[model samples]
Target: MNKKRLGPCVTFFPQPTTLVSTIAADGEVNVMTASWAGIVSKTPPTMAVSLHAGRKSYDNVKQSGEFVVNMVPASLAVEADYCGV
Candidate 1:
């Protein structure tokens, strides 16, 4: 018997896209697309989303003290990509 060998995987993109919403203290809102997110504390319904520090959404989230994470559907991929920009 012969088995094909594949090298060890490094990174994968298996998560659904998300539109993270945040607002500044002055009520300015910002949204950004993210895939590096998952449940951290299920009982409390908390999750962590990764983003670069320079992003407006990051600043908004820190300033606002809260955020809304919206899941992106397959039908909305195009729009989601657009929204991230």
Candidate 2:
């Protein structure tokens, strides 16, 4: 029998820059630029985000369970980063 070897360690970005926009029950919409969202469950197509407690988007997420995740390319990275503000 022959044994196979794996390559050395490598680092890479997991996801593209994404801007998540959410709206509260009062219709106040907020956008947050995030690079830390991941799939939480495959069964329901759920996603998890690492949002701080004080963010506007965080409040929106709590008020409304729906949000849109928009991916950004390098050309639009600066614009996407500004969405959180």
Candidate 3:
């Protein structure tokens, strides 16, 4: 077998996608498709999702300190893509 070195990078092929739903203090609901979410700890059963500061989801999470991470099923691929867009 042949091998080659590559530059520093992060890759999670076939990563599981998720729909993160959040509500603001004003009761405004928002849902965003996230591919950069995953379990960060096992003992504490913690998870993490990456969101930009300027995004509505980020604001909602920050304001309410609550969010739901829903797993994306194959049947909802279209809907998930729509949400991400």
Candidate 4:
């Protein structure tokens, strides 16, 4: 059997499409679609999500100190894609 090598990049497919919601210091709400997310803890029901440093959601989440992760169903793929883009 032969194995092929993959390049270094964020290529984890079949990832859960998630909508990350965050609030700003001034009570502004922001939502960001993220595919790089996973459960980090079970006892506290915590999750880990990766976001670009320059993104608004990242700053909002950092400032507000919390976020909400919503899983996207198949029926909402289009809307999810829009948010991700």
Candidate 5:
């Protein structure tokens, strides 16, 4: 048998990529790729998504106080890549 060691890091395979859509104050729709999202509560059916302060969607969410999460399937890999960009 072979043995190897790796440093501490975050690693999760087959993560469900989501396109978080938010509406700006000016009624502009902004979408961004988010992989670090998950269910925060099952009873209330709530989810949590992390966003960078510099991201436009962050401000949009702050202003609108709402967002929609669209899950991306394997078939939409290309489109997901586009959204990620």
Candidate 6:
């Protein structure tokens, strides 16, 4: 087997798209589409999500210390795309 170098880049196939919902301390609700999330542990049933500091979802999570991750179906692709944007 031969391995070719492909320079530094992030490449992960079929990353699942999820909807993350959060509510701020002021009762402000926000939902954002995220692909940068995955399971980190199985025994404890833990998962991880990545969000930019400037994003509302990040702030909401910080303020509330909670969030909900929802799996998106193929039928809602259009809505998911809109949310991601």
Query: Which segments of model 4 are wrong by more than 4 Å?
Result: 1-3, 7-11, 41-44
Worst 10 residues of 6 by lDDT: 76-85
What stretches of model 3 exceed 4 Å from their correct place?
1-4
Residue-by-residue lDDT tens digits, candidate 4, 2-83: 9978878667568777899898898888887986898889999888899999999999877878898899888998888776
lDDT of 4 at 7: 72
Report the number of the highest-TM-score candidate. Answer: 3
Put down candidate 1 lDDT per residue, 1-85, tens digits, no spaces: 8997778966786888788888888777788898688889989888888878898888887776788989888899898998763
| Clash-forming residue pairs, model 3 | none
Q: Which candidate achieves the best lDDT against the true structure?
A: 6
Q: Where does model 5 exceed 4 Å of error?
A: none
Candidate 3 residue 32 Cα shift, in angstroms, is: 0.4
Q: List, residue by residue over 1-85, the lDDT tens digit for candidate 5.
A: 7776667987787778788999988888888898788888999898889999899988998888999998888799778778662
Which candidate would rank higher by TM-score, 1 or 2?
Answer: 1
lDDT of 6 by residue, 5-84 (tens): 99999898786778999998988778999878888999999889898899999988888899999888888878888877
lDDT computed for candidate 5: 0.85
**Candidate 4 — which pairs collide?**
none
lDDT of each: 0.83, 0.79, 0.86, 0.84, 0.85, 0.86
Candidate 6 Cα errors over 4 Å, as ranges: 1-4, 7-9
Preferred candidate (lDDT higher): 3 or 5: 3
